[model samples]
Target: MSLAQWHNKRPPAATGLRLDFDDGGSEHVSTTTTSSALSLLSDQLATQFDRYKNEMARMFQDHVRIVDVVDRVDSLLAAGDGEAAPDCQREKEAEASNAARHGAELEERVARLRAEAAAWHPAVKPPCPSL
Candidate 1:
């Protein structure tokens, strides 16, 4: 029932390990070895459980992040499709073409004006000098 009683109740009946010099002491090598091995196994199991839990947490986080990214991509695709309809694309292309044509016409006008100035001001040696 008590520590002293348990220790005192048993005689010097241990194996040859404790083996007192006067043959009065005792020891339990097998029992201690078995207990030590069990303790080590329990510690290893706890360590492995902790590692497994951390790995699972990381996996769940990554899964959540991937799901969020997928949701964003899906929404972007939905919005893109709605905004980039066929008519919208055609309109954008037409606008771009018109702008390019206008730019080219402006460039041609500038060139024509420069040539006219050069022909009208040959003796001046410089075109649009006042400008």
Candidate 2:
């Protein structure tokens, strides 16, 4: 969910009663008025939640990719003791290491973002008992 999806202003449907009044002295006079401001908070929040989940999944994918690379490298290193070229072995090891580090970094970022999102999410209340 991109932040762009959220509405910066309330929606027309979300509007509620807004009351106002005025008092006058001497002759004595009074006035009142009301208005409502709609909102799209719920929809925005849902989008944000979905985005968070998507990003987390992407992070998990990164980790899986790294693991796969490492496994492949291990296989190549073991399959042929002499067949594996020095440059090929070095490149595979480096690529595997880089992928692993990137995966870890992505995971860490996802965790922190999720934590932050959780903090901002509304508190859930217990269900009300039936009358």
Question: What TM-score, computed on C-alpha atoms, does each candidate reach?
Answer: 0.45, 0.33
Expressed as tens digits, the lDDT of each residue in 1-131 for candidate 1 is 89988887756555755554444322355567778999999999999999999999999999999999999999998989976798788999999999999999999999999999988886675456674
Q: What are the per-residue Cα lDDT tens digits for candidate 2 across 8-125?
A: 6434452233222222331122212211111355667889999999999999999999999999998887897577588788999999999999999999999999998898776766
- Each model's backbone clash number: 0, 7
Global local distance difference test of model 1: 0.84
Clashes of 1: 0
Task: List clashing residue pairs in candidate 1.
Answer: none
